[model samples]
Target chain A: MSDELYFKPLTELAALLDTKKISSVELTRSVIARTKAVDARVRAFNSYDEADALAQADESDRRRAAGKARGPLDGIPVGFKDVIAVAGQPLTASSKMLANFVSPYDATVTQKLKHAGAVVWGRLNLDEFAMGSSTENSAFRATCNPWDLARVPGGSSGGSAASLAAGEAIATLGSDTGGSIRQPAALCGVVGLKPTYGLVSRYGLIAFASSLDQIGPFTRTVEDAAVMLGGIAGHDPLDSTSYETKIPDYRGELKKRKGPWRLGIPKEYFGEGLDPEVGAAVENAIAFYRERGCEIKEVSLPHTDYGVGVYYIIATAECSSNLARYDGIRYGHRSKEARDIIDLYFKSRAEGFGAEVKRRIILGTYVLSSGYYDAFYLRAQKVRTLIRQDFLNAYREVDAILTPTSPTPAFKQGEKSDPLAMYLCDVYTIGVNLAGLPGISVPCGFSSGGLPIGLQLIGQPFQEAELLAIAHAYEQGHDWGERHPKL
Target chain B: MSAPADLNIDHVANLARIALTPEEKAKFARQLGEVLHHIEQLRKVDVTGVEPTAHAFPVYNVWGEDVARPGLAVEAALQNAPAQRDNMIVVPKVVE
Candidate 1:
């Protein structure tokens, strides 16, 4: 009974909660208790208020009992990445810079979740300022992969995935900037989706790279991810970047598996650094699709090699500008020893920012510097257009592109100390973001070490529903979605 | 790769307004040089006449009704301030 309740998909839990078969408080407690038991090793949550969670859960129960349950997420518990604001709650973004800072307002997504009747809980760990590939860069603590305690859970969204892998949360919200959501979701063996850029509001998500950053969901199934996306997606007047498009029923197409859909296999993704086991598993998935009357074709995204270089230059350039707000005056840490304004700016930032963040900031400042702007940042932006055009060109030939989410399965924590090595982990997933295309990472198989490997599907802009359907077709054909980590 | 002599790490740090210790300066200089070396690969692509995409989706003049709306209270806004005086965020004196 405990196992059944703890790992139940968000959709299943929603149904159970609606029917009163299990109360929200019970479900919330079970997840909280499970987190306490396993998070010592998984290190998923940075902070969780049990009393606050219970109160929300208890309130949800009363509302449901009165037949006044809110929306689909009513009575469900969802965790938030530390970057997303929750009113009066810690919004650390996993850095010492904002270690003691609390949000003054609820983020649009948070407000949406509350309106949906979901009990918001937990400040999930992330790379400090959402800047690194591994949660190892978090100033607070590194989150561990539930599949293998020694391996990283992938990152930026590492804690979101780790929490789900260990059954700590029913579902989670993670932000993707240069594959922060999809890469971690792939590494940790859960279903995660990054909607087409601007589909979800970014009003209160602490900016890392404004252009590339987008908020999405992590769940155990494509259906749950679709449901989570539906609850949070739509135009928000507060976020000027939020897409002004009709929000469709994201789960409507999950049930439509009518065949003969075209899937593009990018030759670039299967190249060097791909582990043989992971390649074979995605290959198997492709074959499974082919036998079901689907057409699989080889497509070229020729500018793929430039994705990483272009992404770093562009992402960091924007990051340096966005992060300038943390000047230690209005909010966050201040240097106690500074004798003047200039001294304070230098000391507080040096003391507060992490090494990875500092490295990116310096690089960003250099790229945008007077002599180098045309040579680096401008050049990268031009290349970024080519990279984006490559996707636009590919989608004309096929309905979607399929690739291995990461080059390999999860690696050991601290295995990659080279910053470039860490950046390369997002190679397969970054270009999709550059093009503003929607993409998802769902478990395809496991490696010899029992770590999960993910297969990604990229869809055309504003077609997340169709994207979810294709993922659902593959997910329902296999038991990958059902396999939970043996915590 | 050896560090580039053209760019001084301290100058860049000054541009970023973050003062690093001597040890941090040396370490950042070396590491930033390595990453810049990696990023130099972008120069190989011929992007002549390619329009730079600052955003994937272009939405313009996203105006809203300009009216006074209730915002965070003074106390709430100042909740995270490092120092506050007279219910205002206190900072170093900008003028004599």
Candidate 2:
């Protein structure tokens, strides 16, 4: 019973803990054991402290014994992407620059989870600075897709997705800048949600693209995703961009907002580079909605083609600005050989950053540079306005937009060595970030070759309740998420 | 407008404060040229009166109270610094 406890959903585990059927220690130990057993192969965690996790579990057990159980997340083991700061823990972001850096303070989400009695588990791996689609850009190790070990786990939040799917954690938190959470969740056969921008605080998250980055959850089921989202969704004064809107009871709203929603199928999502197997899976999902009395319509987002182009410019520009804090004089790696102050900055950055980080920084710097600012950076920003309008126009007719989470299922490691080819992996998902809408990827079906495919539901801004209900509606009829990877 | 192929890698890398090797400069020049060529499609979009969106949800004039709050302790603040002395981050000489 303890061996399989890690695979249980948060709701089920919460019930057990409430009934005193299982101790939080028992549940946490099971998850820690599972991680130790399989993380050698999955390469999901950057670092974990078993003693610290057990200590937190003990504290949670004490709370429950005192009839002070905080909530559903109480005593639950939840992993965090290394990009989110967990005080006193190594927050590497899977980058060598901060390989030895420990977070000084907890991220707002981390504080909230702890307040809810969650056992803060481990620091999960990700693409260095959350820059790449595939976890291959991680300076550490590439996280393998659990379904097929040779294949890549779609990433920047690759470890967050893979860990949940592999039963290493009951649920995990991941930051999605573009498709980091949803794409990896799709690949790893888990439920991943990117909340509406500014819904979750970004105070302690290692900045990538400030305008686009959002922290969300990865869980085995849509219901679990809701529970996790509720645990972390609220405004923080620490993050100025965090909106001061009332965070609804997302899990409760799932049952209340039973929607025969008007779902829009964006035609651009099904074209050209989409893999047929992935396409069939999404089409089947659309058909599922149609049969269930939900109105499905064909919608055109004309600026969809320009999403990738606009995103590359905007995300990179923001990143180049955000990442400038990593000078050698402060925390993180410093160059051993430097003659002057300027030389130190150049040598430190060159030596500390990975290839992809360097490439993006250069591109970002170039686009935001003196002569090209109007043509590249400013032009991309204007186009961003158009891309956002495309979504708002569609929402006037439909409650949510349905699309594939990723154009293709998880590709083999090193399959896409070209940076351009790699950037295209995010084409289907970038538009949501550009528009600041809530999006979720629920496992729709599996490919013939056994890769999992995800169906994405893009909801109106701050309407995660409706989106999760719609996702939960489809997820109820399917067993795609229940069937775990045979690791 | 300058062509995408006209990206000067040396100039950009210098601005970014990243020292690139001769090999990296050449490789990046060719690769970024391709990416820039792809991004050139944005030029075709008519943006006569469009407003640039810096953030998806623009929250303006977010003023917090002027009360002082406790921040990281001195010891905690310098925990990750590569070089430090008396809680101050050590840096190379700036004065000539």
Candidate 3:
């Protein structure tokens, strides 16, 4: 009923729904309207389904009125990154290879959200096969940053982060491989979580890098992130890698959160490449936490320097294998008039994959090939073990680690044309994924250029509840979340 | 590291099943060298006697229950393929 519905926190929305101050249908309608108003300029969503969203919201309203409670995400309108399957809907990954592809069943994450009574608002855009750091690699139109359309929203989950930043959707699901979730979240000035590997099921989500990919939520606030995470964070029989640990009440603990928490600052994070403005903002965040009675200790993660190299090998190798199924067989994208099966394979992939994707796939296949595996892929995996050990040792002495999420603020679109240049932007983030630890990017401050800077918090595997509590406390202590883009 | 020209762009292209123009091969050779050089930084670290782990954490095997589950129908499976013939996807002859 109020304009505040788009800006209200998820917990507040849930409370209003519980007290019937705003009907589920009304909330869904309002969000749908906001999305229509803003998305034309933002290009955040690849597919918008107002009829389905309203129908689901009506169902949620009926359930609530009948006193049949589902979960915390009840009546919330959330968006799905296009790569994720949404049952009987398209799952294109924004690639021509899957242009007409429709999923037969919901992905595991989608099933969980639906079970929690959340309305599936629409499908947000993403880079093709989640390949690039910027959504510019998308075979579809690029997703613009809400703050400044000329600058990029960090990518491949660019649209997911942009949608949340523009208030088009209260929350959206994003898949992080490398820094897909964190980078975009930082660029768009939103809260994005990259849950520890296997913490959430990847069964229904399209594979980017099987080992590196983890689906998480992007929201405007820390509390909203916790609430949305609660709905989708548990074991699923269909996804073998799903967590077996108990799903804690993240929202509840965050509400009563008090901190004397130990925050680790890895010396490796504040190194040569970090921009001055970004570095100052992170230091300020650490000082803010120190004032909140949280202990700050400088820690070492020696293998941090090798994180990008190791992750690239492991991720690309897995991508080569995972994407092998798309060789003009089974489903999606087949080349016509091929001389034979092999030519069909060649032509299909040649026509299907974009430049960045081709580069990774080639590198991956080369590393995993016979005679090269021991030298490249095997060596990278060995280093990956060392990277994980670095985190294990650091966590023994700290509750969570804080660092700058990216080396620099959002660069102008096309500034990083060289693939390696783009890859370096993930230097701060790759280490966490290689260690299989949970990480979140929270807006810390704005650069002198008015672009946002993000501070990352890395937690041990399955420790999202503690992570959220710390982030919630930090959000309250600082006025960062109060800031919004001038779009 | 191999010379930029000696990087076997053709061999890599064959393995990746991508057709590349000569210009593309030359261009990618330089790009791949740059990336490989960046990757060579990992070689500086001492990883002697360390056990290799493909997964970040230890897990014997992560798998779902082996049960027959409903899948998309045959028609649905081939719906998106650009070229299909006789209820099967048509591709170039695989055997040389």
Q: Model 2, range A359-477, lDDT digits (tens) per residue? A: 99999999999989999999999999999999999999999999999988899999999899999999989999999999999999988999999999999999989999999999889
Candidate 3, residue A122: how far the Cα is off, in Å: 1.4
The alpha-carbon interface RMSD of model 1 comes to 0.9
The DockQ-based CAPRI class assigned to model 2 is: high
Of candidates 3 and 2, the better by TM-score: 2
**lDDT (C-alpha) at residue A121 in model 3:** 81
Error of 3 at A334 (Å): 1.9
For the predicted complex of model 3, DockQ is 0.58
Which whole-number lDDT from 0 to 100 does residue A5 have in model 1?
A: 78
Point out where model 2 deviates above 4 Å.
A1-3, B1-3
Model 3's CAPRI class? Answer: medium
Q: Best DockQ goes to which candidate? A: 2
Q: Candidates' lDDT values, in order?
A: 0.90, 0.92, 0.85
Tell me the tens digit of each residue's lDDT in model 3 across A1-487.
1255876667788899999899988988888888888888889888887888899999999999999968668998889999998877888898878877888778888988999999998888888899887798888788888888888888889999988888888789999988899999988888999998888889889997887889999988898898888888887777656668888888888867687899999999888999999999998889899888889999999988898888888888999888888786766777775677778788888887777788888778877887778877888989988999998999999999999998998888888888889988999989888878899999999999888889899998888988988888878877776677776
Better of 1 and 2 by DockQ: 2
TM-score of each: 0.98, 0.98, 0.95
Report the CAPRI category for model 1: high
Tens-digit per-residue lDDT, B1-96, candidate 1: 656785588888899999888888888788777877888889889988899999999799999998999988889988888999999888998777
